[model samples]
Target: MRAFLRFKNSLSLAFVAFFATTSLVSSEIADFTAFDVNLTLALLRKDQKIEVVVRDQVTDGCWTKSNAAKTAVEKNLIIAGYENIVPADDNAFFTIEVSALGYDTGGNNCAVYVSLRAISGEADRYYMNDHEVMAINLREQFSSSTLLTGPKSDMTSRINDTLYEKSDELIVAINAARNSLRKKISDTTISEQKKNGLLSAFSLD
Candidate 1:
């Protein structure tokens, strides 16, 4: 009986350890994704140009509203003081791709999925096929879904509101990163030339 009890306790301990490891892994993944996102946002400068592309995958008779979605996203970006372009010109520093999937449920209820991806135009080297290859290096994404119930106009307004909120969130994060960079620049331990180089990299000059 004592042996059985010991085995049972060991099993319980093993389960606890397994769960603790799983939780730690999940936290690490969240932190990694957030770090990448902040890094991408931090690279943006006020004078840099961005491109916005919208894709609509709605099949519930709401595909026609894709144009409106694109317009709303562009308007929000412009309002946030980010210059937005179409067709992704050569001068664009980053490209934001917006993918939207919408469904029209019964009784004027609608479900929408909105995703945004930011990709930097800068390229970096990576190893593949036993050789070095260069490709666009930075990318990050965010997505959310919600249900709306209202008239067509009201629904449109809600969608635009969501876009505005997301744009604001992005700008806020970018500003936070900029503030952090500025703080680093003011650190007295760093050499003056290194500080100036950092400023130039971020276009703070």
Candidate 2:
């Protein structure tokens, strides 16, 4: 009985150690695919009005580093030459950061755009950030405009940018083509009883 109890305690200790190791591994950045982002505030004041940009855009060809992207937006809040009575955070605010999963493409291909949001009590609070950061997302946010013509608009964006946004028919056709390959995979994972069961199930219905 004592030997059995000792064995049980040893098993419990081993289980605890295993769980501890797993928890540590889960918190660390073991994969390059996972990362951290820092969003900054970009705010400016002009003509009795203020503009602010916040949150990095999640599109293609954006900031390489999440933290740097975030810091860029925060620069707009700096008011070196201002009157007294200043608030701690300053009412004009903005935040910028890279998308967590980078808009979720198929593989390691990162065409994701860093987000930058500007905010102010002036005309259109979201567009107050500096041109460099705001240009990244505003172009995508209002891409339907015909005014942005010339060589820029004709450039081919990444597949997910427009392909995912395409019509339902295109989406269906893509799915059908992909599923055809799946059917081939299914054909190989077959069994005699599995085949009989599949036939019987379909025929009965």
Candidate 3:
């Protein structure tokens, strides 16, 4: 009887540990493809206006040596008309970090990976941190090239093309994440009055 009880306790402990680890992983690297923009926007409709700031430190790796990631962020954000506010704004805001950007030209040919994080608010009031990763491959274009041999210019061209192709997708992810954060703030920290005040102050009402 004692042996069975010990076994049960061990299993319970292992299950708890497994669940904790799974939750941590899920919170750390959420894929943007799974984002629900409509739901998040609905949740944020009445909340405070938010600001955006882009991080300068773009992730560097094999394919990122050419500033492809940074260029993509600048181009896409500009196209989307996203305004980067200063510190004096005093409203709810989020900073975008380009956490990962790289390419792999091995095994099955070419692959591009991009990761972004949206860190909401500032200081103690800060509440939400969301992350998303997008990875794509060019098997159709590079499957025949076993050596992956290409000039720097050619690689740059391919990288730019891929980044442009995924630019709209990245914008969608950012929009979804921003709305999700607004929803979180609405549900948890800020009061209705504060939200209304913020909206009024920003002339968004």
Candidate 4:
């Protein structure tokens, strides 16, 4: 009986240790992903232009539906110093596409899901021995959901607000990453010219 009890306790302890290690690994992976995303966002420049596209997928009579979500997204992008263009301009630096779905859950209650993707207008190409090679563009996406209980007349307004909030969040993240990169460049021991070059490379100046 004593042996069996000891073995059981040991097995339980092993399971706990395994779960703890797994949790730690997951946390590390999340941190690495966030860092990678921030580095990518730091490459955006204020002077660059971005194309905006929006899709609405809400179908309900209770909600006042219109082009409010798209307008909100465009407004936020313009506020962030990005020129919003349509029809996918080849000269644009990025294309921001947004999709929004909403649900009216009876009596002034609603839920919305919004997703945004920023795709690089230019592709990264690999060349070998002056021969044509492969090229791929970068895409980053984020999503958010919100639930609100308000007057029926305010449904459209609330949806627009959510869209604006998500767009602003993305811009804020990019700015934060850009500022961090600039600060890192400034703190380095490199010469002023080299520092400026680095900043320019990252579109920080």
Candidate topping TM-score: 4
lDDT of 1: 0.55
Per-candidate Cα lDDT values, in order, are 0.55, 0.27, 0.38, 0.58
lDDT of 3 by residue, 40-79 (tens): 2222222323333332222223353435555565566666
User: Distance (Å) between predicted and true CA of 89, model 3?
Assistant: 18
Candidate 3 deviant stretches above 4 angstroms: 1-65, 83-94, 99-108, 125-167, 173-203
TM-score pick, better of 1 and 3: 1
Give the per-residue lDDT digits (tens) of candidate 4, residues 1-205.
2332343344334324433433322233222222233444665556555677777776564345546667778878777787645555445546676666777777756666656667653333467999867444445634455555555567677666776787887888778877876786566565687667656655567
RMSD of 1: 15.8
TM-score of each: 0.63, 0.22, 0.34, 0.64
Residue 29 local lDDT, model 3: 18
Clashes of each: 0, 34, 0, 0
lDDT of 1 by residue, 17-38 (tens): 4334333222333222222234
Lowest summed lDDT window (length 10), candidate 1: 28-37
lDDT at position 18, candidate 4: 34
Better of 3 and 4 by TM-score: 4
